[model samples]
Target: MRNLRITLIFSIIILTISCKNKEVKSENKNSNIGQFRFIISDTLAYGKNLARISEYNRKLKENESSVIAVIIENELEDGSTKIDTFSDGLKTPFFGISKYQTGKHKIEIKVEEKMMRTKKLPNDSLSLEIKDIYYTYKFHVFIKDKVYISELNEILSKQMDIEYNENPI
Candidate 1:
């Protein structure tokens, strides 16, 4: 009888502790958990532009969030595709160490201007054009050593679309 009472008391204490600061988790895709984001210079990413690209990769390492972005072509209603990114963050040269973020959260960004791209021609003619962009993603979250997880692949992440120059130069 004493053992049963002790076990019941202990279980209540554990349940009460677990209720604090609980994360909203779900296994569904619409569960709002798997979103992640990062602001990477499109110039360095593509093989086209070299002049505007910095040796900055060797000089300075960005405080890059661990979100791998998979951009796809945006299909328009007219059967034309456009890169439709509009960024509202501070348009600054990508620099400085970003702040550390909590795991399983996503980055949300508001855009003040639509993002665009520019091309320099062989005869020094500059062709400026806007790209229609769309994105899909794969997720990877770095869990700390002491953390526990009931599910791994279903983990979600997010980041703000800040510090990216629309047309890098």
Candidate 2:
């Protein structure tokens, strides 16, 4: 009977060590960001121009839906232009000058979504602009809904530069 008890105790110790090791490995895996991709395309370009930006989220949930905001700007040579913003699942009207020279214009899209629950009121805002080209776009995602704003102001002053350039496209 004594020998059987010793064997049982040894088995229990080994099992406990194995379980702890497995848990440590699982935690390490969770610490790394999972893979994800965001597709951005110029749907109105008639298959001529396109761009895309992608990012990975470490804590992204498997069954969560993400909100995306897109903006397109048309720049003219004579120091004038138009701006447009579109949401992920909405259609936007194609508006632009009929015959305008197309140069190295700027196209920017800002996407923001809540990754985790927050107690404070959510006021997330992201804006993108190309100054020399005279174009800009802004997108804000809140807990309740999302907003898209387009403006043609002169190259954003230095103060607003941080907000526009730091946002993840």
Candidate 3:
């Protein structure tokens, strides 16, 4: 009986995985993906720590689908690099353009979220706030070139319902 139960459970799990993959493959054939590209034009290398704060302002409409969140990383000296992410409802996205940066850094900047939480407020709350967790970003970054942080483009974004508290000070 024990062996039979184990085999049955294993078979069910395998079947579930195959079913989900099939659905995703069919969905992708009709998906319309949006793309945003920026070119950083700084190529001078120096020895020092660098840090900069930036903002992300993109308005996601009701039920507007978003692709993967992009990560911009500046590899540091101790095998550690500064990283920032851009995605839907990313409240605060701060980066060091290269903080305490020991050397010159890369050409892109993305914001970091200090405090991001999704929870239902009290029943007596007066506001209809929707804190939706769309999905964890599929991580990808291009090691293009080294540049200063000032060249980042600033744009206007919409307000979100997610409660963001911390400031990256």
Candidate 4:
């Protein structure tokens, strides 16, 4: 009987440690900003002719889709800023362009709850399920040279930060 009691106590301690490890793994997964690829095809082109190309992959539920929210701030030669905001999905490669030509540009990309897609269910119903899914990502890029593609690509590529977050509901 004494041996049985000791065995049970040891098993309980092991079980507790296992549970704690699982919890820690969950937290790490939530905080992880996975990898992505971003390239500016025409980095050396004029500001208005420049284009952005990127790709990111994520597993989503049947009722869910991936989206990207972007904010672009371009500083003109006269010291004024042009701001643009738009949203797009990640099911395919992302291609985008800006309409300004001179000065510097700051680009910010976010992937969060607000990027959620709203779709009607088969029976025209809506349901919510609480799941342990959290994704948060932020990517920043700066464009300074709008003249030579090779040089600008080298400079802008060095300034790219391709982290993003996603916590879907």
Give me the candidate number with maximum lDDT. 4
lDDT of 2 at 137: 31
TM-score of 4: 0.40
By lDDT, rank the candidates, best first: 4, 3, 2, 1
RMSD score of candidate 4 (Å): 17.8
Better of 1 and 3 by lDDT: 3
What value of lDDT does candidate 3 attain over all alpha carbons? 0.30
TM-score of 3: 0.25
Order of models, best TM-score first: 4, 2, 3, 1
Q: Model 2, 1-169: lDDT tens per residue?
A: 4433433343333322211111111111111223223332212221122222234343533322223333456444464665544332211111221113332223333222212111223475322211111112322211111122112111222323453366422
lDDT of 4 by residue, 1-169 (tens): 4433433343333322211111111112122334344454322344542333354556665554333433345445565766654333332223334434434433443322221333456885543322222232333334435454555444444433232223221
Instruction: Go through the candidates in order and give each one's C-alpha lDDT.
Output: 0.25, 0.28, 0.30, 0.37
Provide the lowest-lDDT 10-residue window in model 4: 18-27
Stretches > 4 Å off in candidate 2: 1-59, 62-64, 75-80, 90-99, 114-169
lDDT score for residue 157 of model 4? 40
- TM-score of model 1 (CA atoms): 0.18
On lDDT, who's better, 1 or 2? 2
